[model samples]
Structures are given as C-alpha cells and as structure tokens.
Target: MAIGITAVAVPLANADVTTKANPEGIDVSSYQGSINWSSVKSAGISFAWIKATEGTTYHDSRFNANYTNAYNAGVIRGAYHFARPGNSSGSAQATYFASHGGGWSKDGKTLPGAVDLEAGCAGLSQSSMRNWILAFYNTYKSKTGRDVVIYTTRSWWSSCTGGWTGMGAKSPMWVAHWGVSSPSIPAGFPTWTAWQFSSTGRVSGISGNVDRDHFNGSAARLLALANNT
Candidate 1:
C-alpha cells in the first residue's frame, strides 16, 4: 500500500493464483479502509502483513486498528515499512519504524518486519542506494532480531541495487511479480520467502482490491520463520 494516501480504484484479484499453492495470504494497508478481518480469515487467508511506517516520519494511520483486529481474527500478522531511502537515512528510518509500529515480536506468529522497496528509490544513484539499504537492513535486524525482507520486483531490484548478491545471504526476500508462473527473483536471493503475486486481489473483508501473497514453505515452516527459530 502507498503511504499517506487512499486508493481510488484497485482492480479485482485473479482467483486462479490460489490453485498453485496452499496457505496463501494477503498484504494490505490504509488504502483498504475498515477491513472485516473475520471475513478475511474465513475466506482462508492464513497470514497478513500490514503497512506500519514509511520513510522516517510517516505512520500508517490505520495500522493499530488493522494490526490488532487482524490478530484477533487469527491471522498471523507482520509489519512493513514503505521505504523512502532518498528522503532519509536508513538507520533513522529503521528506528522510526520500530518506534511507531514496525517492530516484530517472536510470539510464534509475527513474521519479520519488511522494507517496501518499490519505486521509492527512484532518482538515487545505485551505490548510494545500496549503502542506504544496508543501513536499514542492519539497523532493523539489530533492533528486531530478525532479518528484514527486501520487497521488490525483479526489474526494480536489478535496476536499483545492481543485483548485489550480499543482500540475500542475510536478508530474506519478498519478490513481487504479477501474472507470472513463478516469481522472477533477482540473482542475489537464493529463494524467496514470500511472493506478492497480485495487487488486485479481492477477498471477503476488503472492499477493494488487496494484494495476494504466498509463503514458499509449509504452515509450520512459516511459523518457525515468524518465531525466528
């Protein structure tokens, strides 16, 4: 979800993607307002990641509500930061994310915090952006005790980070590739932990299109990842 804004038109989700995997989930933010998490869970959503903070200053206004409600509805929940690396230092952004809403706890259900690295890095030079991402990654890992997931499309990661392989050794990946048989992860990551396959997904509770995702492992393995075990 985009930071500090509401979505006007989110296309309907492709229902066909669910056939390829079990234990699928969704990612959402302030864009889909007032979601009925009960319906979402009932519709077979096993997990969720909510937008918590962006850059170093902005917080998702709907974070607490969605976070608490989603947990109460029995969805394994996680938090993510919509990164703006060009705007602020990654350490500050990590600290800001942890302070407001992006911290992850090992309750056996909360996945590691993620950095949303989409087009937010536009205009920044490749080397500076790489260093910026490292700063965020190290700080977030130190604070949360879990490696952050680098969420990006293959083209974007390749274009911005120059396909730096060091990032994948410690950081897990969340690759977004819409309408493909398999996610085209960049060269760095060994395997993707999560894949956001579609942005225009329709579920029970969300009024508009929500992002659909899939974990690469079984439900037990997913819990272990969340527990950081």
Candidate 2:
C-alpha cells in the first residue's frame, strides 16, 4: 500500500447500471432503510417508486415517510402495491391501496401507482390470474382515473398468465430484469413506461444495493403520463 497513491472507487455491485441509460431512477421499500434522498437526487436519480401497500389490509409501514421525503428532496415520487390475489378480491386490494397512499395526481410529477404482478400469481392458473389482474385494473382505474403500470418479467408473466394480452392500449409496463442490459417485457404491453434493469445497483445515499430503473421515453413523456395529458 503506497501512501501517495489515490485508490480508485469500486462499487459493491452492478457498476455498469449507469451504462444502461442516462436518466434513471429507483424503487425502494423499507429494505433500503432511511435514504439520503438529497444525496440520491444529487447523484442523478430522477424518480422513485416506493412500496405503499399489499393485498387488502397490509401496508408498507414506511410508505408515507418515503413519499414525503422524496417529494421534499425533489425526486419524482410514485407508489406501488405488491399484489396478493389470494389474500382477497382484487377490487378490494385496489380499494385498499387507494385508501392508503397510492393515489395519482395531475401535478405532472407524481406517477400513477403500479401493480406488481409476478410470483404472487404463482400456482394459480392463467385464467384465474388474468381475471384477478383485470379485476385490479378495473377497480383501480375507476377509483384513480389513472392507468396503472404493470410490473413483471417476461417469463413470469408468460408462465403465470399464458402471455395474456388483455389490457391492450391501456396499461403501461414496468418490467424488471436483474443484472441484464435490457428487460424483456410481456407481450401484453407492447411498450414499457419503465424498466427495472437491476436490483444489485449501488447508488449514493442508499446504504445497500437498490433497484435501478430506466424510463422508456423522455422525461417529458413521464411528466405527461403523470399529468395524464
């Protein structure tokens, strides 16, 4: 070890996440713990989706805290619900989500809530799972007047839903693919609004690895979607 030499910084994981895209963002639950959102914003994170609720009753304990802090830190804030079709009716879940902190606004900054559909639908047949997803969307849209984003990997969606394309022309996708250069989304949603490219991403302000994401189009489009314009 030389005293005069400067050591180069090495990331703990997924150092190549920046190479995946330019205006990227993150998604977090209580998993990341307390985040230094100002530092996160200063590090070039453009937006964030925080876990808000799940099923018909359980809600993320840290959702409101993260939501307010992200807004105060100048990060575009959004909420997401971890689906549990087996726990209760999908409409009930949607209603529960909105009752919590999952409402969308026309502020041109807040993103509509996204429904995470994947392993939760595991073991259920494609037909039953599709019905549940439809039930969720129907009630969620009716309540929020905003289209919800669907998050799933191509394989998970295909296997669970038999590649169902029923939500045509409405739902945008937020596909997740860890450690990959690009995400492969389900056929149901032709284009994606966001791509969660890596979960092992190292970003400033967050102590551990965080999920990294890229918006499909420009930031303007994102704001437009938020505003529902």
Candidate 3:
C-alpha cells in the first residue's frame, strides 16, 4: 500500500517509457483524506483504486465517498483489499471484501477488485502463503465472476511465495516498484498490467502524498479491463 512510507523521486529515464504510453492513475486510502474528483480528472488522471477493506472487519472509512465520487467525476475506479493472512482464512477476508465494497460490476468505469499483498508475508511460509492467496482469488472470483487483481512487489512475491508463477495466467498483476525507470515484473507475470511508479506523487485533488500509477496500455485497453471485454 506504501502508506506512510517515505517517497523517493522516480527517475525520468525509467518512467518515460511507460508513462508516455500508459494512462496515468493513482491509488488512495483514508490517508488521502477528502479528494476533489473533478479536479483530479481535470488534472489528467484517468483512473484510481481506492482502499475498501482490510483483513476481515475493517472497512476504509473513506471508501464510499472515494468510490462514488471518483465514478461521478468520470475517473475509472475500483476497490482493493489489504490482505491479512495470519489473522483468518483467505476466503474469509475475500468474502469480507466482496460484501463491503470490493465487488465488481460490468460498468465501464469500474475495475476489478485488487488484493494488496505486502507487509511482512503475514507470518506464513511460502507454500501456505501461496495457498492463502489462491483461496482468496478463487473465493473472490466465485462471488463476483471476475478475476481478482494481484497487487504486489517482486521482492515480496519472491520471498513470500517462492516466486510462484501459477497466478500469471489466472489474474492480472499490479506490480509496485517505486522510484524505478520500470517496475520489475514479479515471477508469475511476464509483464505488469499496472505499475505504481512513485509513492510521493502530488495530484491536483489529493492534498498529501499519493501513490502514482500507470495502466500498462491505452485508455481503451483500460476500459476493456474495467468491462472485462
């Protein structure tokens, strides 16, 4: 999630290739406070992933406003869950996410829900962590009829899941590697579907630091993803 983390300047040499072709976006949580979606859209932001739920019981306090306002302002938006593997079963957390705000719809402005998979591996071994993630994906799919996006980093994926490659074919990857020319693709994915390039970004509507991202393709491709076309 990169919340509360120090931001590093992303190198222009590395970011130019992706940002030039990809749609600019951001990910926000309650930490971002109130946002002006119209200004965000006017500032050339195209999409967002807002924090929805974490673990099994904690819903992001600002989720509803962020989700609805982003959509109303014409920014393609989606919800994400911060995973908690050690506290409960993956299925439980996915169920909680879907019921809260992470459920997907066919509307052209809503992206499929994502699961944030970082923060110390949740004390699980590689194999257990892999199983837990698969369970969450499967449960979320069954509930929403859409594949859950996997949000992670190369180092975390490698260390926690032993570089598992099974998810590449089943889900889209939102790889996060801050301050880089290009994000490193995790083991299971050949390429990133979305890239979080910097955590210290300044967007028009967001008052504090926000995580900046890019959809790996054009705007139409992003629409296709949102609509599952």
Note the clash tally of each candidate: 2, 0, 1
Give the candidates in order of lDDT, highest first. 3, 1, 2
Candidate 2 lDDT trough over 10 residues, lowest sum: 1-10
- Candidates 1 and 2, the one with greater lDDT: 1
Stretches > 4 Å off in candidate 3 = 1-20
Residue lDDT tens for model 3, 77-177: 99999998999999999999999999988766788999999977878999999999999999999999888999999999999999999998888889999
lDDT values, one for every candidate = 0.79, 0.78, 0.86
Looking at model 3, the pairs that clash are 14-181
Ranking by TM-score: 3, 1, 2
Task: Evaluate residue 223 in candidate 1 and report its C-alpha lDDT on the 0 to 100 scale.
Answer: 60
Q: Report the lDDT tens digits of candidate 2 across residue range 1-229.
A: 0111122332323112233233689999998999998899888888889999987778888888899888877677789999987777778988999879889876545788988886556467889988988888888899999777788888878888888988756788888887767777687676667889888999999999999998875555555555566
lDDT of 1 by residue, 1-229 (tens): 1111121222122111122244788998999999999999889898889999988778899999999998877788889999988788989999898878778776655777888998655688889889989999889878877788788988888788787887877787888999988989876787788899999999998998999998886655566566565
Who wins the lDDT comparison?
3
Superposed on all Cα atoms, the candidates' RMSDs to the truth, in angstroms, are 8.8, 10.8, 8.1
